[model samples]
Target chain A: MILAIASGKGGTGKTTVSVNLARAFDSEIQLLDCDVEEPNDHLFLKGAPTGREIIGIPVPEVDEALCDGCGECGRFCEYHAIVSFGTTPLVFPEMCHGCGGCTMVCPVKAIRETAKPIGAVETRRAGNVTLVQGRLDIGAAMAPPLIHAVKARLRRDLPAILDAPPGTSCPVIATLRGADFVLLVTEPTPFGLHDLTLAVEMVRALGIPFGVVVNRVGLGDDRVHRYCGQRHIPILLEIPDDRRIAEACSRGGLIVEALPEYRGLFRNLVGKTMFRTNPKEA
Target chain B: MKVAFTVSGGDLAAPLDSRFGRAPKFLVYDLDKETFEVVDNRQSLDAAQGAGIQSAETVARLGAKALVTGHCGPKAFRVLRAAGIGIHYAGEGTVAEALARYRAGELPEAAAPDVEGHWA
Candidate 1:
């Protein structure tokens, strides 16, 4: 089963949950960090990337010689990246979505496509889990495409744990695609509850079964718990607030590896998640 | 020579539209023939991005030699400048009042764009 660990708000311990859960699986499991804008899972994982690949999108390049400025490309382009004012076409590479419709609509064949680097995806083996991460270039708005590239390497034979980007927008929606089950990670606070409700609405609209994992459980009131109970959503696991866990995380150490005590907790969490996602197999 | 005035409506009595890209309409006035035409700028108004450049392209296509608006971003300014179209800045008022200012040579030529892109 492909389970995605997602959070509506940032810094709610999604990487901590994802990495720890991946370690719980003894078999060959895949871990895909779909947060291309800022992937931090590699910090806690061991080993260097065995394979590296750069990912790019095709942006339009115009030929001024064989062209009349019909303004057709500008009129046809929905993104407004390409436009012809007078007899010259101006292209903003940063705004191009790589749809290739501009080139196709060019009557004079003056528009051609060129590769524009968006980001890179690196693959490595970190103990029992194979970690794959997509890192986007700074100031690039192409995170969704690179995230797709990282997910394209999922191993069907093994269970894939996807760590999604924060929020309820394009990047988050892109990562949620094809996920068998979603694990919504959130803290038990007012902001957390507000964003979590939005996330729940998004997942429900996507029609994916999801459960909540409340991190730093005792730090806030039981509102998140109460909300979940009212909605009848399963509480997968609750990791208590502890300075020791924070200290380990700050030093880029896994909670399971440093404490050794929480290894079973994470393992049990994984098992419960698997059972919920696939009751027949469990 | 023809002059383009960004407007809120499609008539002479329409108020001047300060927004260059998202203006509802443009009045293309001919200096020689003393006739004018209104061009729909609703497409640029609804454009997701590059509204300025698209509107500038429309102005160029209509063969306007000058532009009268309250604001112009750097991108749209570049497009109009490259098309050899002169840009002038006018304050918020009726289109007829703006035209009177233009005819009386009260408006100043903008050396650079007055506002940033997507300000409207």
Candidate 2:
């Protein structure tokens, strides 16, 4: 089963939950951290990556010598990344989405497609789990393409867990796409509740079977539980505010390994996810 | 001058329709003329969620001289500025009230939205 762990807000212990869960599964399991922009799971995982691959996107490069600056490329680009008037054509790399529209519209073929390295995907062996992660290049605005690159390395036969980026944006959608189930992690706070609603809406829109994992459970209100109850979404696991766990996270350690007692919780989380994903498997 | 207003649906004056691309039933008033033109923004694309630049382009294409809205990001701000459109920030109350404030020149000119990513 491909399980995707996602949250709408940052700092919700998503990496912690993912690492611990991967450790608990412990047998040829694959963990793909699709949070390409700020991947931290590798910091907590075991040793250096065994494999690496660079991810790139094709962006248009204009050749000024070709001929007259007709401004057709600028007119065709909906992003306005390229704007030409009279004799000059301004190209803004940051605004470019790599749609290749400019190259197609240029009558003189002045625009050529060139690859720009956006990020890299690294695969590391963490005891039993194979961790695949994407690290975006600094100043790269686009993330979805890099996320797709990381996910493409997923091993189909083995169970995989995808740690998605925060929020209900395009990157999150790219990470959660094609997953059998999604685990929405959130804290029990007002901001957490608000963002959780957004995530829930997003998962529902994607039509993926989902459950909630309330992290730092005792630190805040029970609104999250009430919300889950009202919506009939299952509460898979709840990790309370434990100082030991925080320290372990700081030291790049998994909760299941640091505190042994939490192993069962993660195991149960996997069990619930499996049952929800495949009722016949139960 | 014709203008477009960008509003996230959660705003009080935001139209009842959830289709974000459609413009809410709001008016862009001309303070000099003392008259208002109810701008139909239904045809414009929504920028409230993702791709602010695209939304800014939609607003610009609508021939808006000024944009009134609650919040905008840096990328969208740059695009709007490049289009030569004035921006008004913290526009509250009903859409009409905000337009009145714009007409009265009471609302401060909005500074460019920060360019840092939303997560940061």
Candidate 3:
């Protein structure tokens, strides 16, 4: 089963949940951290990456000497990343989606496609769990392409868990799109509830099966519970506001290792996730 | 001012006419002419999963002064705003209702949608 761990807000224990869940499983599992911008799962795992590959996006590079600015390339580009009216065409790499439409539409063949390094994907192994992660180049604005690169490493035979980036935006969608199930991890705070509602709508819109895991459960109000209750969405697991867990996380330690008892909690969470995804599996 | 509303299906038909009752695949309406034209977003070449920023810019370039849609993200919102196009966040409503609400001044000013990812 492919499980994606996500949260509507940042710092909601998404990485923590993902890492622990990967360790909880007995079989060899692949843990893919799709949060390319700031991947911290490796911090906890402390495993040296065994493989690394650079990811690139195609951007239009205009050869000014090739021909005059006919504005054909700019006209053909739907993104408007390339603009040329009276003078030489100007290309905004940031706005470029790498559609190659400009190259195709360029009448003079003045535009050539070139790869711009966007990020690098790293692979590592921790015992039975294989960790694959993407690190976006420091100045790169896009994360989806890098995420796609990381996801390409998914091992079909091993049950995989994707640690999706926080929030309900394009990168998150890109990461969670093909997963069989999504595990939304949120706190019980007002902000958490607010974002959770948005996330619920998003997952529903995508027609994906999902459940909620309330982290730092007792610290906040019951609004999350109330919302889940009304929607008939099951609350899969509740990890309380434990200082020990927080401290361990701050020191880059896995929750299951910090408090061995939590291993069972994660195991149970995975069990529930499996059952929810496939009732017959229960 | 000429405004654009994102519609889902092509052409206008009831149940589908208002932007309030249902979300438009994406629509661009000419306010002065009171004529609504459906923007063809079905092509994979311009299909952006979230906010559809590229599509929004296309509508803006087509001389739309404002936008009406069920939702939009920060990236698209910024692009629309930069293009001097206003945005109205109308939850799944018929295109006509959204347009009517805009005409009646009942719709809130288009602000950047919450900065959540595609899932939010």
Candidate 4:
């Protein structure tokens, strides 16, 4: 079974919940961090990456010697990533989507594909947990592909826990796809509630079973509780407003390891989440 | 010489638009015939990205010798400059007034793009 942890609002402790849950699973597990733009799970874990691989997308490169500047490729490109002005088509690698449309449109076949590094995926083992994460190069617009690359490391026999990127856009969708259950982490603030509603809509649209995990619980008002009750959405877990946990997080310490007292709570969370997602398996 | 003036509407009396990439309309005025042709610019306005480059393509395809707009970004400026299309500065006024300024040599030729890419 695969469980995805996501949150619409940034800094809602989605990563905190995911990293701790993986530790309390009590079995061989794969922990994949799909927040390619800013992955921080490895920092919290206590092992060096055993493997790393670079990933990239193919962008167009124009060969001026092979042809005339017919401008056909320029006209056909919807992105206008390549523009021709009676000279070799000027190719902007950043803007190119690598659709191969420009190459097809070039009558002389002057356009060739070249790989541009977007990011890299690395794997590390923190005891029984196999952690895979994608780290995108700064300024790289594409994240879905790198997230897909990290997902490639999923160990099918073992249950996988995916920590999705914040928000309900393509990257989050890519991370949450094909999960057995989705756990949305949110704070109790009004901003958190707003983004959580949007995220709930996204999960419902995708036809996935989802539950809410309210982090920083006692600090905010009771609106989050009222909203969840009204919607009939279950609150799977609630991490109270604790300064010790915050300090542990700041010091790059795992909640399960630093505060062994909460180990039972995280364990119960995993058990309840599994049974909630699959009643028959319980 | 045909000059392209970015405007909010199709006529010479229309107000000049202070945008290049997403300008509502282009008034291509022919100096020899002293007449104007209008090109709708809604396509670039609705584009998700690359509006500046698409708008420059429109000016080049219309055979405009020069472009008069509020500002132009680096990418669009490169395309227009490479096509040998001179760019000039225009402010808030009627297209006819902008054309008069161009004829009188009052409009300064832009050495480089005045605004950043995709300002519109």
Residue-level lDDT tens digits of model 4 in B4-115: 9998887988899999998888889999998889999999989988888888989999999899998999888988887889999988899889889999999989998888
Each candidate structure's TM-score, on Cα atoms with residue i matched to residue i, is 0.83, 0.71, 0.69, 0.88
**Model 2: lDDT of residue A271:** 81
Q: Number of clashing pairs, model 4?
A: 0
Model 1 alpha-carbon drift over 4 Å, by segment: A275-282, B1-48, B54-65, B69-71, B82-84, B89-120
Provide DockQ values for all models, in the order shown: 0.45, 0.08, 0.05, 0.68
Per-residue lDDT tens digits for candidate 1, residues B18-110, read 889988899999989988899999888888777888899889989998999989998889889888899999988987888888889898778
lDDT of 2 by residue, B1-120 (tens): 854554444333653231222335334445566555554544334333335555555666656778776666766676677777787764346655666577688867777673343422
For model 1 the TM-score comes to 0.83
**Taking the tens digit of each residue's C-alpha lDDT, what string does model 3 give over B7-89?**
55665443332222123355667777778666555442334532345555466667887776666665566556666777777
Scanning candidate 1 chain B in windows of ten residues, the lowest lDDT window is B45-54
Candidate 3: CAPRI quality band = incorrect
Q: Chain B, model 2, TM-score against the native?
A: 0.64
List the candidate 2 regions with Cα displacement exceeding 4 Å.
Answer: A86-88, A275-282, B1-120
Q: After superposition, how far is residue A201 of candidate 1 from its true place, in Å?
A: 1.8
Among incorrect, acceptable, medium and high, the docking class of model 2 is incorrect
- Expressed as tens digits, the lDDT of each residue in A85-138 for candidate 1 is 657787878778888998998888988999999999999988898999999999
Fraction of native contacts (fnat) of each candidate = 0.46, 0.00, 0.00, 0.62
Query: A18 in model 1: Cα distance from truth in Å?
Result: 1.5
For candidate 4 chain A, the 10 contiguous residues with the lowest summed lDDT are A273-282
Clashing pairs in 2: B3-B64, B23-B41, B23-B42
Give the distance in Å from residue A118's predicted Cα in candidate 2 to where it truly belongs: 1.7
| Candidate 3 root-mean-square deviation in Å | 10.8
